[model samples]
Target: MICESFPVGPFQCNCVILACEETRTAVVFDPGDEADEILGSLARHQLKAVFLFHTHAHLDHIGATDLVRTKTGAAAGLHEEDMPLCENLHIQASLFGLPTPPTPPIDRFLKHGDSFSFGKEKVEVIHTPGHTPGSVSFHVPAFGLLTGDTLFAGSVGRTDLWGGSHPTLINSIQKRLLSFPDETAVLPGHGPRTTIGRERRSNPFLV
Candidate 1:
């Protein structure tokens, strides 16, 4: 398994590409922006996209989703509860003062425990809502976890915007995310990667 991460778009949302070195099959998690760079990188690695998944539908996390799917013929997936946010891309873009881009409808709606296999690698969907009613995280036992805008390195997602709620986000963290192993590598949406144990001990929100 091979994984790569790079920040994209104006908000610098982290876009991750995970692939199986043997099968060359891959998945793109949060193609926030810069379609050209994302596509170019995929080409460089000679990886074929199997699924395009998002942790949530915040504008910064989905700016390049439509473009990536169209170019790669990849099936797009999101948590069912976030369909509204996916459909409201334009509104979010406007609110965030970002340039409006064409957004695509989600082709697959994932439920908690639903699993996806791309090449030899596998990912399990964890419905860790609270950042938004539909926020989710992707967990790959062999690699790491892609946490979107939910749980961060030392901080957690703010629940003051949109469907966000402070209590809910905190609950999600304590119940859903904190259960993961201490060694699980956490790749977040907007910052450097860290481990579950690190955040558990130091995060103000968790402490």
Candidate 2:
């Protein structure tokens, strides 16, 4: 398994690229922006993206979904609960004073406990709401977890946005995130990476 993550878009959302070295097959997670750059990275890695996944439909997270899909011929997926948010991409962007980008049609709907594989690597999808009703985290047990906006390095995601709930976000963290091994690495949607144990023991929001 090969994994790389970088920030993109005006909001600097983290876009992750995970590939199976053996098969050269990959999945792009949270393609927030910079479709050309993302494609370039994929090309450099000799990867053929099979799927483009969004942890939620937030504009900053799915900004380049259509462009990427159109270029890579990859299927796009998002949680069904975030469909409304996905459809309201333009509105969300406008709220942030950014130009609206086209929202791509979702090719598949992801749910809790769902899993997918590329060559020898497998990823598990865990539904974790509260940052947004459809926010999810992807766990690749051997590598790390791709936490959309649910859990940050030393803080949790903000709940003041549409469909966000503070209590629910906390619950999602305790139940979904804390359940993992303490040493498990966390690749959040934005900011630097951290370990589950670090956040569990010291994250002010969690502690």
Candidate number with greatest lDDT: 2
Give me the candidate number with maximum TM-score: 2
Model 2 pairs in collision = none
Per-residue lDDT of 16-109 in model 1, one digit per residue for the tens?
9999999999999999899999999899999999899999988888889999999999998988888888888889988867778887868999
TM per prediction: 0.97, 0.98
Q: For candidate 2, lDDT tens digit of each residue in 1-207? A: 888899998889999999998999999999999999899999999999999988999988999999999999999989999999999988998888988888798999999999998777888999999999999999986689999899999999999999999999999999998999998999999999999999999999988
- Whole-model Cα lDDT per candidate? 0.89, 0.92
How does candidate 2 fare on TM-score? 0.98
RMSD (Cα, Å) for all candidates, in order, is 0.9, 0.8
Query: What's the C-alpha lDDT at position 129 in model 1?
Result: 85
Stretches of candidate 1 exceeding 4 Å from the true structure: none
